[model samples]
Target: MADLPNCPICTMPDPLLAADGYECATCGHEWLAAPDDGLDDIRDANGNLLADGDAVSIIKDLKTDGKAGGIKVGTKIKSIRLVPGDHEIEARVDGRQLLIRAAFVKKA
Candidate 1:
């Protein structure tokens, strides 16, 4: 993060490599340098792909709406895709493909 100091609030070490940047590991601070964090490991703390993701998981107790609700942690998910939204995750669960929020799930 050029010109911008790592978040003072969160004293997390940011290892930027020119083109892209991301949040500090210690703190949930995201750094947006001029471009993307080529490292593209931008998963939630749980490691779930942030929508349009390419993996799946059930490592956390996730709450759902409509007919499906209460997905127990450790529920294995597959074919995850990342999306652009608050809960950024697109995967198939219980045979029903839907968009899941990243914060709610973890990597498998």
Candidate 2:
């Protein structure tokens, strides 16, 4: 339905409206619309809903610019900005701006 929004957790386009809230078929996470803005919650890897300025940590070592020295596991990334794409996480690491996949990080 046009009125119903996409699931914030899995980004599923269609979610069923239950008595309590909207239930996502993809991830099965139920969410209620925010009373103020009507936007659903966006969850991080740890099932914690993420917001701007939230701190997250890398789950694994990630290569950058084809370098052998990559971002280490458990690297703490701060003040992350959540974009529209499922894996898009914009943040600055070591004074360099980069885009990190959401699946590789957890809320810190």
Candidate 3:
């Protein structure tokens, strides 16, 4: 199949697949991977650093009067994705997974 195939790692030229990942022929460094669409970072309510796409717990009980209402403390959120904002995470809890400001939710 003749096509413009760039290195999966560096998005540059493709090398002979070394061990697992593709190595950049020019840089001499192996590029690891591309993050998944769901892969992202999230912070906790106390403002602590959390991992990208992690399950976190709500330390403080949250009261929402919107479409999705009320998340209690110690609630666990799964597959939380981080975005760039004052509130960094997009997550779901209870009946609705919603965008949560990282300053509000902490890493479980």
Best by TM-score: 2
Instruction: Identify the runs in model 1 with alpha carbons over 4 angstroms from their true place.
Output: 1-41, 46-53
Candidate 2: clashing residue pairs, number: 0
Residue 55 error, candidate 1, Å: 2.8
lDDT for each residue of candidate 1 in 44-100, tens digit (9 for 90 to 100): 665534444355556667667776566787787766776555656667788777776
lDDT of 3 by residue, 66-101 (tens): 855588777888888776666567776666767777
For candidate 3, report its TM-score: 0.52
Lowest summed lDDT window (length 10), candidate 1: 33-42
Q: Residue pairs in steric clash, candidate 2?
A: none
Candidate 2 achieves a global lDDT of 0.81
Order of models, best TM-score first: 2, 3, 1
Question: Between candidates 1 and 3, which one is better according to TM-score?
Answer: 3
